[model samples]
Structure formats: structure tokens, C-alpha cells
Target chain A: MGNENRIVNGLLKLHIALCLLFIFAPIAGSFVFSLNSDRFPSLPLGEFSTEWYRLIWEDPLVWQGFANTVVVGLTVAVIATLLGFGGAYTDFRYNFTGKSFYLALAMLPPTIPVVIMGLAMLAFLSRVNLSGTTISVIIAHGVMCSPFAMAIIRLRLSQMDPDLEAASWNMGGNQWQTLRYVIIPFAKPAIFAALFITMAVSFDEFAVAWFVSGLNETLPVKILGFLQGQVSPRINAIGSLAFLSSMTLIILAQLLLRSPEDKKS
Target chain B: MKVNAEMEQQSEAIVKFDNVVKRFGNFTAVEKADFEIGRGEFLAIMGSSGCGKTTTLRMLAGLEDPTEGAIYLDGEKVNGKATWDRDTPMVWQSLALFPFLTVQENVEFALKMRGVGKEERRQRAEKWLEKMQITEFANRNINQLSGGQKQRVALARALVTEPKILLLDEPLSALDAHLKVRMQAVLSNLQKDLGITFVYVTHSMSEAFSMADRVVIMSRGQIEQIGTPEEIYREPYNRFVAEFLGSANIFDSVITGPSGSDGWKVDFEGGETSLSKDELPNAVQGQAVTFIVSAENMQLSAPDSGQPGILASVAGEEFIGGTAMVFLETETGHELKVQKSHDELSLLNLHAGSKVIVHWAPESCHILPGENL
Candidate 1:
């Protein structure tokens, strides 16, 4: 029995390692090639160089795309987290008819096909004269990212004792005061986690931004432009940079998601 | 003079429920609750879960609005008043201490909501922290404190506002047996020292009887009886209260006729007994009645001793601290309980299946007043 268990465990570990390798190998290849002094990504021991990094660093278009992405990401994070917190608190505090329907609708956007969502958003934005701008990209990204924020915050709220809010009111805190003091403080960590995760989601989003943004293209759209015009190692460099930033945001969010007591220990 | 004093006491009631009824959808949570909590009285509302004890407390706290009638706080009709508008603070069963806040901050929260100045808030909160004997842990997070310390913090937080009345919902139900006793003392002393009316809701009889000056017993959304613990224990209002207390043996009987000049004769399933006229006033012959004999009043004798008692076999024994409870089953299948000291039990040489005679004096039996034929 012990030998059979050892064999099963060993096979499970190997399977997990293989899955991770398959997922990360392409990204690792891009990171490695972004530093090689080769025009083509054929890896036959080219000298390690920073040429692609310098090229992307000096490009005005690259700078514009990066700036737009940062602005859009931050604004989308704040907007989405506010909406998410409201949606989550409604689910937490009240039990009215059609509540389940409301929650299902709130959580329905992300599950929609991105292509269909992009098309619908483009149609809506164009009719409202909001398309072809950074604001349009942000609006589209916010619509897609709010559900992620809501899910994270909702999980945290479920862990709260239902009596905490009532206890606050019993102690003379009005509705708004209880929200500001009790509910918000208890959910502070999740709120921060939601912000970071939504920002990362917005940062990495491309399909919706591509459809809505005409001239004010975000980083991902600009990379697509680079890919179409020419196969360049600079795209690898930009991809590596974007991947690094998204990973950092996700890691920060994971840290915030840990209980405060866990941090002290 | 006594009438005038009684009127004054009635006017001094800190909280009053005036025929209040609360229903959620089709289910009635509280049914026509009419009671008054006097100034500085520690009143406990007790029942098993779903008995509306907590519902009654919640209605008083303004957390749940009564569907009918009104609630008054300190001579003011507080119907539809938000809980935040009332000065009634509650210590929750879950403690519900803010996990993110330090002990001092948790204590200061009520004052902060009331818009007290920063300096005064700190001073007042610190005073309560010291009063609760948790001043040293003031800066520590709530989760860092032990359960007893957290309980003290919860008390301190609720009391910082100096409300006229404090509500507690089984706040000690989570503690161990030893700690529960200690906290009971803490709460009892705190209520006396503060001299504020306290409305406590609990299902534990020991907690309610030990700490409360008066208790309101509820069952199935209705108040069974409200009296001092001793009064309710010695003379329960009905069969429900007797069974709920679980320390008395109840029997169904009917008044046969007058036993003598001053006593009436009654017949039960087990045997016949005589009750003094004072015990069953206005007794009608052939009217069904229910009476209870408390466990402590019962006696156990050897079956062969020719005692005038119900013959029974020992069912079991339960040890409760310094005393033991001997349970017996009569030949007619009526279960009876007798509480005695271990030494007394040892002298009787009782065990499971041992034949014994269960008997109680006629004066020891009290007829339930609420029973109807």
C-alpha cells in the first residue's frame, strides 16, 4: 500500500510540473529572446544585449501606449472596485426578492465571449461618440473587470460574522457610519486585493480595448500593431515587461488576501 | 402608601413592550409580547432556540420592528426608531468585536460614531479598558486576545456609551463551564455597579437564574411566565415551565372531592393524594389538574420497608457536582426524579433496577395555575 501510494504521489507531482512547464515555457522563451542580440528569435547562442529594451524604451509610440495603459488600468481599478463593493454589500446586507437574479446579472459580464463583448461595446461606444479614445478603453475594461472585483470582495464578506454589522448599529452607529467603520475595515484587505486584481485584469486586457480604442491604443493593442507590421524581438521585450507588471500586481493582491494575523506570524 | 410606591415603580420602568407582535412573512417570531423592565433590573429572557426569546430582545433593541403595537424606552414611544437612534447597546453571542481594530479602538468606536472629541474618546475608552481589566492589551488586535479578554473588550465597547440599558444575547454561551461561571460573576457585578437595566437573552437555565434578578420564560413565541428565578423554580406557572425547568416530576390528576374540612382529595395515575384547600382554591370535583413535585422534595425508600409511596425501580443516576440525581420508573411507567447527596444515595444502596419507593408530602406538590380541564 505504501509503495503504491508513493508511486501515485510521484506521478501527480510529475503531472503538475509538466503542466506548469507547458504554461510558462513560451513566456520564458520570450523573456530569454528579448535579451539576445538576434533579429530573429532563433536561439543559437547570440550575445546577451539590451538593444531591444533600448529600442522599445526610446519609441514614442511605445511610450504613449504604456502611458495610456497605466492611466486606464488605475482608473479602471478604482471604478471597478467601487462598483464591486456596492454590489457585494447589497448581497451581504439585504434579502429582497430578485436578489439572486441581481447577483447573477452582476456576475454575468466576464463569462460573455470576449469577441462578442468587444463587438457590443464598440457598437455602444461608437453610437455614444465614446469610441476611439483612452476613456473608451477604460469604460470597456471597467465593464469586464468589475465582476472579478465583486467576486473577490464577496468571498471576504461571506467570512464576516453576520452579527458584526448589527452589533455596530446596536452601538449607536448609523448605516453609513457602520459601513465606514465596521464593514469597510473588516473588508479592507479584500478591497485592496480587489483593486490590484482588477488593475491587473485591465492591464492585460486586449480584445475589448482593441475594439474600442482607435488612435489611443493601449500596450496590448500597440503590441498587436507591432506583430502585424513586423516580427520583432522588441515585441518580446514589451511582452516580458507587461508580463512582469501583471505578475507583480497579482502577487501583491495575493499578499493582501492573506489574513492580517497570517502577516504577523 | 404602598400603592403610591408601586405606581412609582411602574413609571420607573426603563423599557416596555405594549402588546408587540413581530411576524416575518407567515411565521410569527414574537406573539403579543407585553412586559416591562424596571429601572436597574437585570431581566433575562430565556428559552430554547426558536422560542422567540432573542426575538423579543431584538424588538426591544430596535433591530427588528414589531408588526403590531409599540415599544417604549424611558417613557418615550420608540416604535420605528432606528437602533442607532436608541442608546441600547448589545453584547452579541459571537462577541462581534472588530477584527481589524485594536482593543482600544474597538472600545472607542461607539464614542467615535457619536462624534466625541478625539481626546475624550481615548480617555473614556481607556477608562473602560481599565475597568474591564484589559488595559494592558489595549493596543493589541482583537484576535490577539483570549476568549475571556475578548468578552471583556466586547463589554467595554458596549458600555463606553454609558447607555441606560444594556442587552446581552447569550454572551457567555461560548465559554467553558468554569469560565462561564466566572463571567457570570463579572456580568452580575457589572450590572449592579453600573445600576443600569439589563435585558439578557439566553437558553441556559444556569446562566439566566444565576445572573438575572428576574426571568421571562418563553416557549413557541409566547411568554410562559415572568418572575424571580426562585418563584419560577418553586412554583412554575404551567406544565411547560415545569418540564422546561427539567427538575420536577409532573403528574396529571383530577380533584376527587373534599378530603376533610380543610383539604381536597385528588387522584392521579400513580395514586391518590390530598391537597390543602390553600393549595387548590375553588377546586371542583372531577376537574383535571396538573401538579409538579420538585426533585429535591422527593424521597427514596427501600421498596420492602412498607412505606406509603409509589413503588418504582431505579432507572439511572446523574452526578451533579456535590449532589446526585436518582431517576426512578414506577410500575405504572411514570418517570420520577429525586435529587440527593451522594452520601444519602450511598446509604440507600441504590443501583439500576433496584426497587425503591418514591414519595413526597402533599404540601410539597404544587398545582400548575395555568392548566384548564
Candidate 2:
């Protein structure tokens, strides 16, 4: 029995390791090639160099794309988190007709095929004369990211004692006061987690931004442009930097998403 | 003069519910609840789950508006008042302390909502923390506290604003037995010291009996009985109260006729008994009646003692504190229980399957007033 259990556990561990390797190996390869002083990504590595990083650092267009990405990511994160908090709190506090339909509609944007979503966004934004702009990218990304934020905060709110809100009211706190003092404070960890995760989502989104951002391209769109233009190691360098930043945001979110007690000062 | 004083006291009740009815769609949660909570009274509304005790407490707190009547707080009708507008604070069953806030902040929440200045809120919250004997843990988060400590924080938070009436909905239900008793004492003392009316809702009989000045027993969305603990225990209003109490041997009897000038003969499943006029007033012949004899009042003896009592065989014995409860089944299969001290039980030398006679004094039997005989 012990030997059989050991075999099963060993297989499970090997499976997980294989899955992680499959996900991270490409990013790791790009990182390694980014440091190599090769013109093209060939297997026999040249001497380790930061030449690609230096090239991207001096490119004015690269800097512009990076700035646009940061602004769009930050603005989308705030807007999505606020909308998500409102949606989650409504689901928590009220019972109404078509609630499930409302939630499904709110969560529908992310499930659509990104290519189709990009085309649809382009069609809709251009009709409003807002296409090919950073605002259009922010709007498109915000639509796709808010659902993720809502889901995270909804799970956190579901774990809350429903009586907490009523207890606040019973203690002479009005609805607004209770929202400010009790509901928001209890969901602070998940709210911060939602913010980070949504920011990362906006930062890494490419297809929709590619369709909408004509002149003010985000980093991902700019990276795609560079890939189409030339097979340079600078693409690998930029990819490695973007992957590192996205992973950092995700890891920070994961840490914040731990049980609220552990996050206390 | 005494009647006038009593009338004056009734008018000065801190809270009153007049013909209050609460319905959730087709289900009635509370039906025509009419009661008044006197100033500084410790009133406990107790029943099993879904008995509308919590609903009643919520209505009093202005969390739920009465469906058809008015609820008055401080002699003013507050039927449509929101919970925040009422000065009624409730300690919830789940404690409901703000998990993200420190203990002091959780207590100050009510004061802050009331727009109290920061220094005053801090001082008021600190006073409660000190009173609850949790001053050292004031800076700690709520989740960092133990069950008993969390209970104290909940109490302090609810009482921080010093409302005229405080509500508690089974706040100690999650505690262990020992901690429950300790919190009960703490709550009892706090109510007395503050001189504030407390409307406590609970399902535990011991909790209701031990701390409440007046106990309202509810069943099926209706108030079955309301009195002091001793009054309800000694003379239950109906069969439901007797069974709910679970400390009595209830017997359904039919009034045979008048035994003499002032006594009536009654026939039960076990045998026959007679009751004086005072024991069962206004008895009618052929009328079905119900009476209860508390476990402690029951007497047991050997079968051959020639006692005028029901013949039964012992079913089981349960030791409860300094006393033992002897369970018996009569020839008619009626289950009876007798509670006695260990010394008395030892003298009887009773065991399972042993033949015994179960009897009680005629005066010990109290006829249920709500039997509708």
C-alpha cells in the first residue's frame, strides 16, 4: 500500500512539474537569448551581453509605447476595480429578478474570442469616432478585465459573514457608512488583489489593442510590430522584460490573496 | 396607588410591539407579536430554530419592519425607521466583528458612524475595552482573538454607543459550554450595570433561564408564554411549553367527573388520579385536559410498596450533576421520568428492568392553562 501511494504521489508531482516547465520554458528561452550577443536566436549562444536591452532602452518609440501601456494599465485597473467592487457588493447585498442574467452579462466580455472582441471593439469605437487612440485601448481592456476583478472580489465577499453588514447597520451605521467601514475594509485584500491582477491583464493584452491602437500602440502591440519588422534579439529582450513585470504583478496579487489575517501589519 | 404605578410603568416601557406581524411571502415569521420590554429589563425571546425569535428581535432593532403594526421605541412609533436611525445595537450570532479592523476600531465604529469626534470615540471605545477586560488586545485584529475574546469584542462594539436598548441574537451560541456560562454572567452583569434594556434571542434553555428577567417562549411564529423563568418553569402555559422545557412528565387526562365537593377524578393512560379545584379549575366532565409534573417533583418506590401510583419498569438512569434522572415505562407504555439526588436513588436501588411505582403529589401537578379543555 505504501509503495502504491508513493508511485501515485510521484506521478502527480511529475505531472505538475511538466506543466510548469511547459508554461515557463519559452519565457526562459527568450530571457536567455535576450542576454546573448547574437543577432538572431540560434542555439549556440554567443557571449552574454546587454546589447539588446540597451537598444530597446534608447529607442524613443519603445519608450512611448511603454508610457502608453503604463497609463492605460493603471487607468483600466482603477476603473475596473471600482466597477467590480460595485458589482460584487450588489450581488452580496440584494436579491432581485434577473440577477443571474446581470452577472452573466457583466462577465461575458472576457469569454468572447479575443480576435472577435478586438474586431467588435474596433467597429464600435470607430462608429463613435474614438478608434485608434489610447482611450479606446483603455476602454477595450477595461471591459475584458473588470470581470476578473469582479470574480476575485465576489469570492472574497462570499466568504464574509452576511451578518456583518446588518450588524454594522444595527450599530447605527447607515448603508453608506457600513459600505465604507465594514464591507470595503473586509474586502480590502481581495480589492488590492483585483487591482493588481486587472493591471497585469491590461498590460499583457495585445490582440484587442492591436485592432484599436493605430498610432498610440501599447507595448505588446509594439512588440508585435517589431517581430513583423525584423527577427532581432531586441524582441526577446522586450518580451523578457514584459514577462517579468507581468509575473511580478501576478505574484504580488497572489501574496495579497492569501487569507486576510496573514496580510495584517 | 399600586395599580396606578403599574400603569405608569407600562407606559414608560423602553420598547413595545403592538400587533406586529411579519411575513416573508406566504410564510409568516411572526404573528401578532404584542409585548413590551420594560426599562432596564433583561428579556429573552427563546425557542427552537425557525421559531421567529430572531425575527422578533430584528423587528425590535428596526432591521425588519412589521408587516401590519407599529413598533414603538422610547414611546415613539418607529415602524418605518431604518436600523441606522434607531438607537438599538445588536451583537450578532456570528460575532460579526470587522475582521480587518483592530479591536479598538471595531468598537469605535458605531461612535464614528454617529459622527462623534475622534478623541471622544477613542475614549468611549477604550472604556468598553477596559470594561470588557480586553484592554490589552485593543490593538489586535479581530481574527487574532480567541472565541471568548471575539465575543467580548462583539459586545463592546455593540455597546460602545451606549444605546438605550441593546439586542443580542445568540451571541454566545458558538462558545463552548464553560465559555458560554462565563459570557452569560458577563452579559447579565453588564445589563445590570448599564441599566439598559436587553432583548436577547436564543435557543438554549439554560441561557434563557439563567440570565433573563422575563422569558418569552415562542413556537410556530406565535408567542406561547411570557413570564419570569420561575413562573414559566413552575406552570407552563401549554403542552408546547412543557415539551419545549423538556424537564417535565406530561400526561393527557380526561376529567371523569366530580370526585367530591371540590375534587375531580381524572383518568390518564397510566391510571386514575384526583385533583382539587385549585389544581384544575372549572373542570368539565368528559373533557380532555393536559397536566405536567416536573421531573424533580416525581416520586419513585418499589412496586410492592402498595403505593397508589402507576406501575412501571425502569428503562434507564442518567446522572446529571448531583442528581440522577430515572426513566421508566408504565404498563400502558407511557414514558415517565423522575429526578432525584444520588442518595435517594441509592436508597431506592433502582436499575434497568426493575419494577417501580412512579407517583407525584396531587398539588405538584399543574394543569396547562392553554389546553382548551
Candidate 3:
């Protein structure tokens, strides 16, 4: 039994190590390429250079794409968090007919194959003449990010002591006051988590952005365009930046979610 | 005392439920509740779970709106009004203390919402905390306090607003037995000192009996009986009330014939018992009625003593310190319970399977009309 347990433990560790290597290998390669002094990222101790970073920083399209991505991502984050919180609150707080069906419908966006969703969104946008706009990217990303936001908010709402809201109301506070003071305050970490996670998702989102962004290319769309055209160490530099920022935002979300909600004495 | 009585005579009902009915979707939560809460009364609505006891209190607190009728607060109709506008506060069983707020902030939440200045809210909360004997924990968060302390904080928070009526939804039900008893005394004393109307909802009969001035017993969304605790304990209006209030030994007794001008002879199993007809004014001959006697009222005896009582043998015994509940199986196999004090039970030494007779005075029985057993 002891020998078998040791073998299992060794195997588990090896599996986890292999998974981590698989995930980080691309990011490590991207980072190395981003710093290579040569054009192609040739090996044999290539001298490190900040030239690609300087070029990307100097490029107008890169700056424009970066700003566009931030704007769209923040907008999506706000809409997704608010809509998600409202949907979760209504779904959890009251009973109504068709609740299950409505919930299932709301959650169908992400599972419907992103390419199909992008194509459908693109078709809708073009028909409405709203294609290629920043709002279009924001709209597409908002639809995709909301279900995830609702899921996290719903999880937090479920863990919440529901009477806290009731108590606030019972204490002669109106619905808005209770929501402001009690429900929202208690759900702060979850809301923050949702915000950061959704923003990261919006920033990293590409296929829908590619279809709808047109001339308003988000960072990911710009990177895709660069790869399709003539990829350089500069594209690697952009990938590395994407990897760093998304990881940072996700880690911030995890920190917020894991923050001690129950205050110590 | 005389002046206080004269003033009390002029006091009106603080909260009134006028033909209120609350329904969620198609299921009714509070059905046809029409009761007036006196200006300074501690009224407890007691029932088993799903009896709408808490729902009734929620209606008064404005947490639930009546689907049919109106609720009045201080003589003003408040139908379809939100809970916050009702001016009635609640101390929930969960305490519902904000995990993010300190004890002071929790106690001052209503005041803050009412737009009270910070200094004034702090002073008022401090005063309430002092009154509740939780002054030391004013700055501490809810998680830091023990169960009793948290309950005190909840009480303080509820009282800080000085609302004329306070609704408590089984606030002490979450506490341990000993803490519950202590909190019961604390709640009663606080209610008395403040002279505020309290509508307490609880499922524990003893808790309701010990603290409430009037106990309203509910069953299946309907008010079964509403009366003072003494009246309820001694004179339950129906079988449901009798059985729900206490450990009652109820048997199916049939009205056989008239014993006298106001009495009827009842036959149960193969035995004859006479009950006062005055107590059963509408009892008809050949009609089935439930015979009820509280476990405390019935006495146990040795079967060989030749007593004129129901013949039975002890089936089980449960002793709770000073009192013992003796369960007896009659010859007809109907189970009857007899409660006796420790000293009284000691002489009989009735263990399991002991032969005995269950005896109670005919007047001690509370008879309720029955359709079926």
C-alpha cells in the first residue's frame, strides 16, 4: 500500500508539472522571441534587444489598437457586470414560471460556437450598419462575457446570507438603499472578481472582435492581422504583453475573490 | 401603577392585520390573518414548520405584501407598501448582521439611512449598545462575537430606531437551549422596558408560552386559536390546538348518551367516561368527539388497586429532571400519557410494561368536536 501510494503521488506531481510546462512553454517562447536581437529569434545566445518593444511602442496603429481594446474591454466589463448581477439577483431572489428556461437561454451564448456567434453578430451588425465600430466589438464581447459574470455573481449571491438584504429593508431602508448598502457591499469581492475577469476576457477576446472591429482594431485583432500578414518578433512582443496583462488581471481577480470577506474579530 | 393602568387603558393597537392574505405564485403564505397587536403586547405566533407563522409576521413587517387585504401600522393602511416604508424592524433568526460592518455600524445602520449625523448615530448606537449590555463589543465585527453577543447586537440594532413595533422571526431559535432561555428573558425584559409591541414568531411552544402575552397558534395558513398563554394551555379551542400546544393524550371518544342537564357519557375502547355537557354545548348524541387531557392532568395508578379509571399498562417512561412522562397503553391499545413530578412518579416506580390505570377528573378534559380520528 505504501509503495502504491508513493507511485500515485509521483505520478500526480509529474502530471501537474507536465501541465504547467505545457501552459507556460508558449509564454516563455514568446518572451524570449520578444527580446531577441535578431529578426527571426535564432538560438545560440542571441543578444537581447529592446528594439522590437521600442518599435511597437512607436507605432501609431499599435497605440490606437491598445486604446481601442481598453475602451471596449472596460465598456464590456461594466455592461456585463451590471446585467449579470441583475440577472443573478432576479433568478435567485424570486420564483417565476420559465425561470429555468430563461436561465438556460441566457447561458447559451458561450456554448454556441464562438465562430458562429461572431458570424451571426457580424451579419446583424452589417445589416444595421454598425459593423467595424468600437461599439460593435463591445457589444459582441459583452454578450459573451455576461454569462460568465452571471455565473460568478450567482455563486456569490448563493453564498450570501439573504436575510442581510431583508434585514436592511426591515430596518426601514428602501430597496435601492438595501441594494446599495447591504447586497452590493457584501457582494463586493464577487463584483470585483467579475469586473476583472470579464475585462480580461474582453481584452483577450479575438474572433468576434476580428469580425466586428473593422478599422477599429483591438489589440488581439491587430496581433491576428500582423500574424496573417508578416509576423515579426514585434508580434511576439505583443503576445508577451497580452500574456502578462491577462495573467495580472486574472491574478487580481483571484486575489479579490479570495480576500477575507468575514472580518476577523 | 394606577396612573400607568389609566394610561394603558387608552392605548390603541400598534399594528393591525386586517383581513390580510399573502400568496406567492399560487401558494398562499398567510391566509386570512386578521389580528390587532396591542400597543405594548408581546404576541408570538407559534406552529410547526410551513404553518405560515413566519409568513404572518413577515406581512406585518412588510417583508411580504398581502395578496388580498391590508395591514395597518399605527392606524395607517399599508397595503402594497415596501418593507422600508412600514417603519417596522425585524431581528431575524440568522441575526443578519452585516459581515462587513462593525457592531457600531450595524447598530447605527437605520440611523445612518435615516440621515442622522455620524456623531448622533454613534451616540445613539452607543446608548443602545449600553442598554443591551454589549457596549464592550461596539467596535468588534459580528464574527467576533459569540452567539449570545451577536443576538444582543441584533437586538440593539433593531431597537436603535425606536420603532413602535418590532417583529422578531424566531430570533432566539438559533441559539443553544441555555442561550435561548437567557435570550428569551433578555427579549422579554427589553420589550417590557421599551413598552413596544413585539410580534415574535417561533415554533417552540414553551418559548412562546414563556415570553408571549398572547400566543396565536397557526396551522396550514390559518389561525387555529388566539388567546393568552394560560387560556390556550387550559382551554384549546380545537384538537389541533390542544395537540400542538402541549403533550396531550387525545383519544377518540363517542357521545353515547346524556349524563345530566349539562353532561354526556362517552365510551372509549370498552370504558365509559362522563364529560361536562356545558363544555360540549354542541355535542350531539352518536357524534364523535376528541377527548383531550394534558399529560400533566392525568394520574397513573396500579391496575390491581381497583380504581375506577381506564385500564392501561405502562409502555414507556421519559424523565426530564423534575418531571416524568409516563406513556401507557390502554386495554384497547390506545396510548395515553401521564405526566407526574419526580416525587409523585417515585412512589409508583412505573417502569416499562407496568400495569396501571390512567385516571383524570372529567372536568380536566378539554373536548373538541371531531369528524374522524
Give the 10-residue window scoring lowest on summed lDDT in candidate 1 chain B.
Answer: B3-12
Calculate model 3's interface RMSD in Å.
1.1
Give the higher-TM-score candidate: 1 or 2. 1
Displacement of the residue B63 alpha carbon in candidate 3, Å:
1.8
Candidate 2 at residue B314, lDDT?
A: 93
The residue pairs found clashing in candidate 3 are B262-B277, B263-B277
Ranking by TM-score: 1, 2, 3
TM-score of chain B of 3: 0.92
How accurately is candidate 2 docked according to DockQ?
Answer: 0.77
Superposed by TM-score, candidate 3 places the C-alpha of residue B89 at a distance from the truth, in angstroms, of: 0.6
Deviation from truth (RMSD, Å), model 3:
3.7
DockQ of the two-chain complex in candidate 1: 0.74
lDDT of 1 by residue, B31-88 (tens): 9899899999999999999999998888889899999988888878898999999999
Candidate 2: which docking quality band?
Answer: medium
Give the TM-score (vs. native) of candidate 2: 0.95
At residue A160, what lDDT does model 3 achieve?
A: 81
**Top DockQ hit:** 2
Q: Which lDDT tens digits does candidate 2 get at residues B19-72?
A: 999999999999999998999999999999999999999888888988998887
Tell me the docking grade of candidate 1: medium
lDDT per residue as tens, model 2, A1-265: 9999999999999999999999999999999999999787897999999999999999999999999999999999999999999999999999999999999999999889999999999999999999999999999999999999999999999998998899889888899888988899889999999999999999999999999998999999999899899889999999999998999999999998876666467
lDDT of each: 0.92, 0.92, 0.87
